[model samples]
Target: MKASTKNVIKSIAVLSVIALVCVAILSLANVFLKKEVTLDKATVKFLNEKFATTAPTTTGTDSDTAYNEDYFVMLTDGELSNASGYTYKSFKSNSSNYVSAIYYAQKGANEGVYYIESVSVGYQNPISVVVSFVIDNGDFSIQNIAVKEQREDFGDRKTQVLNPETFFYYVSLVKSDEDMNITDADIIAATGATTKKSVAGLNRAVTRAIDTMNKIYTKSDEIKAEINKRGGQNG
Candidate 1:
């Protein structure tokens, strides 16, 4: 072959290689810039349906008021204090305890993931629990909870029978209106009833209190299970 023809062929080959490299780079760039599309349509529809049914409707105009209606109403509406003057407060702070449900939609797609997050309260000695949920593809539900801190009135108790740990449990039950109200009921029932008052009446009272708290624990577990089920449906 002629030298000039060989040089021309080599140059053409180099240009072809450069063009191929440019095409490959552009293809990768397009992939990176492309929007993520959710592949699950049924799951997205289920989430939307579930949210429409379960989500609270708020009519308030103010941002804070709307937020309170949407998030804080459930936590505050229940009678946290009973006739015993016991009050229950969540260990999670206002900013932290806030529950938010978010929905993502693609520009041209009908389905996307939903995110939900909220705080749940639970108890342990010298430590209170706050749970945060992060549900992928649906709602953010409580994935796990951690011990935050002890109750506020951990050490201050007026009654000697009210040991700090047990007392906290007792007060929590009363505030939450759990079955622990039976503590006073059992005490009242046992009083003046000569059948069982003969031996260690104080021990019976303590036992009643402990039993009531145990009932609260059982109730709490039931509540947690329900929450988890709801979360699974979406998250």
Candidate 2:
């Protein structure tokens, strides 16, 4: 081959290698990205499915079918406090992880309830749960709970956190005026959760959900103001 032809061939080979490397990097990035994003996707799907009946309807649809709009609002720390009226006392100022998102059940049996989604580490992986908190006359309490995901296999012990009727045993552990500082020891003492590690995970999650509810209650006035500012009236 001529010198010019050889140079061109070498350049093409280098370009091909660079392209392959770029593709590999992008593919790896996508996998890691999905690992983080999958939790969010699952959270959204869980919220929508749980609150599907009460979702708002899109007027232009051919049929009068109501659409489940993305109801979970992931508020920043400032927005959660300043904008959403979340109180500082309800949650531990030093603690970092808790209540990742809040969902409003707009129109159904759960009409005015707020669902707080929280996560805690289990024996193997993170445990995510959503609890419905009802606000009535400035008092807030956990009305129901749904476990979105739990990585551990707890055998029959999962019933302690999964069933609402039985789960109230855990809710009863929380005090309205105080922060929920439940530990593994507390979880083991309060209920028949087989594995202390699993029980502790669920307890921490439940406590966090209650904390979010209490914060909203403490700042009920601010929350009302926020609602009114957005053209909504506090019920």
Candidate 3:
């Protein structure tokens, strides 16, 4: 073969090898970076079904009514105190006000966890107070808890208190127990004082806040149910 022809063929081979290497690297990077996101729709549906199966039915027996009243009384007494407790001290100092809403999530057969998220419309910030419990034979007991502020941006300033793993860890603490119960002290201990600038706005904000908390609590039930259903099928 001519020397010029040989040189051209060698160059072509080198270029082809480089291209193959680049493609391989990209493929590996994509595989490594791919992450599993929210649960699948079908799995969520299955989980909801399982959760319902395992959940205790609410009855109107006198015992049941009394138990519920006891739980509510405990929560109400707690509310009478500063709704957010010491956690709201910072906001109070700055005259940065807040409004809170209580949210409940089922933890097990007779247990439910509560979360109090306070929103400061003045500063556009939200603080979270978590309380968990279980009700056994009509008694409420504390399980776990955490109080913290969420991330936010105030024009030139930005802040984040906990990462996703840590935040989820706090959430899991409340949701993992099967026999935890609710109590008045637990409710009082979980929150601090709340002040809303506008009464109507405060009412609306509190309602929405409670609803949001409830949504998150229900999601745990959905996940557990789905996992159980999938496990049963495999068995």
Candidate 4:
């Protein structure tokens, strides 16, 4: 073969090898990176364990029926908190869409539970979180709180907001009627996450939800009165 022919063949062979190597590396990285972006089996189980409840069985039934389906009764348009008419907000982020919802149950077996789920902007991406506030069925004093899902990343270091124990410990400091005083220092101490962006974002979002709830509770009398007026009209 001519010298030029041999040179072109060698160049083609080198390019082929480089292409194959690049594809292999990408495939390998995808295996691990994909799991981080989506919800995993553990997170699903945690969400159910925290928010799931059983349905009430009828009389003469030996087995208790689990009311897992249709358990959450969303507040109606007029019943929604003063924040917005809908319980859930489709919040659009810079690159992705995050959701924030507020659900309440008053006349069911799951009464006294106020479900709040939100996604707040974090260090690198949006942190999806779900919190369950237990009430006394008559008042808004949160008896307990539970975090269902929290996904956050910071540079090369990811946060453990999904870790049930640690996440709960940090959330315990937040109260229903009281204002959250979670400072940058507090977040760094508790979560070891980003204090400037991630922590602040989470704090502001969570605090706003809490404040909205407080406003609803404080005006419970008026809201209930309106509900009664509507009920009387329907009847």
Candidate 5:
């Protein structure tokens, strides 16, 4: 065949491959379009699932969803002034660790428990997760991490940090975010996907939650900053 003819043939092949890839992507988009996943619904569903294993004990509340804002109060100077007396306090985040909101579980059997809501960036969109902490005698322990939203550019695989069998399984064994990143580095490596930014994003949020809780509960430097912010707001 002539060189020009060969070039034409190669162009055709390349076009065909591009067409096929486009079709495949469109097909996936169509399938995802068929299902509508809203953030609030997903959040509620995650909380419902988390609450199921929890026994109903809080007055006028029966499920884990009861831990919502209506059930728990936000932290104020009163709480800050008497921080030592309070074991848990909830506050809003200013994007620190990708955290948007943090709540304290003050209900029965849930005391010393905290819920940190992080909207971490994934491959393209944001991955919303609620990290829970169960503190005992000043020692904080992570418990049941609920990933409520995964709006990624590549569609939701729900396997990165959300994988319970692998990633989450290892995370469950970790007590602190530092341990998750350092002390239990082997475990995180064993879980795999730590190298991915989505996984790193999740880790960042978790670390922030753990660090924030530690600082808040222990009256760390963060307390001073938060107080200053709150004071400015009041002023």
Candidate 6:
């Protein structure tokens, strides 16, 4: 009986050791594989909490690009104190387009930002993004595009073209006005999408964001009034 009890204790100890090793392996896997907020997932208040800060920007970011991750987080994050006292407003799309929702806010006195949400409709698996931007009165300046919910592959194509070196540079040459708008072909051109079949859904999705922002900035009576009240600066 004494021998049997000793054997049982030894077995239990061995089992406990194995169990701890398994747990350690799992913990390491989880730490390495954790995903970030709102990437490839629809924009939601819950998923966005993790994306509150911008990842250190990529290598190609232009010094003039306005993509302020903090401004976007501020626009979407209701918890943050609005030191600029920006009143939140929603602009709906009456036209037949994928422009889902639009949110605009002014930071302090002159700088303002737009959170234009759009979704890719025809993709096998749809993707979305908030084309966050600042309209420079001097020229077209895209601050940052708050990425979707776009898959890694297609979404990468969309931005690779629109990045500072490619799309912004290309637009600077063709544009005749300081208008904050883009043509459907702009994104298609940006991604270098080819004929027959391609990743062209992002074309309209991104355009919708820019178009919506322009409509509000240029046409909205209220926005004009507010701009005049603040001395008519687009920062």
Ranking by TM-score: 2, 5, 4, 6, 3, 1
Ranking by lDDT: 2, 5, 4, 6, 3, 1
lDDT: which candidate is best? Answer: 2
1-235: candidate 5 lDDT, tens digit per residue:
9999999999999999999999999999998785432224334334435533435332235444543433332345364545533332343344334555555443445544566666656555566677776666756666667666665424444434456567555456454434555433544465754436666566655665666666565553343344345432321
Q: For candidate 3, write residues 118-140 as lDDT tens digits.
A: 44332254443333433345444
lDDT of 5: 0.53
- Give the C-alpha miss distance for residue 165 in model 1, angstroms: 72
Error of 1 at 79 (Å): 42
Which residues of candidate 5, in runs, are more than 4 Å off? 1-48, 51-61, 64-70, 74-96, 153-159, 164-167, 176-178, 183-188, 192-195, 219-235
TM-score of 3: 0.23
User: On residues 1-235, what C-alpha lDDT tens digit does candidate 4 reach at each position?
Assistant: 9999999999999999999999999999988786322223343334335544342221112221212323233444455534343333323332333435554433344444565555666565556555555545555644334544445542555554434556655676564224676666776676655436666656655655565565455445444454444443221
Cα-based lDDT for every prediction:
0.31, 0.58, 0.35, 0.50, 0.53, 0.44
lDDT of 6 by residue, 201-225 (tens): 4555556666655554443334434
Could you tell me every candidate's TM-score relative to the true structure? 0.18, 0.56, 0.23, 0.53, 0.53, 0.39
Candidate 6 vs. true structure, TM-score: 0.39
Ten contiguous residues with the weakest lDDT in model 5: 84-93
226: Cα error in model 6, Å: 8.7
Worst lDDT 10-window in candidate 2: 57-66
C-alpha lDDT of residue 55 in model 1:
37
Predicted model with the maximum TM-score = 2
lDDT of 1 by residue, 86-185 (tens): 2223222343232222222211111222222222221222222222223244322222222223342244422222223333333333334433344544
What lDDT is reached at residue 82 by model 2? 80
User: Of models 2 and 4, which has the larger TM-score?
Assistant: 2
lDDT of the structure predicted as candidate 1: 0.31
**Model 6: how far is 219 from its true place, Å?**
5.5
Candidate 5: Cα lDDT at 127: 69
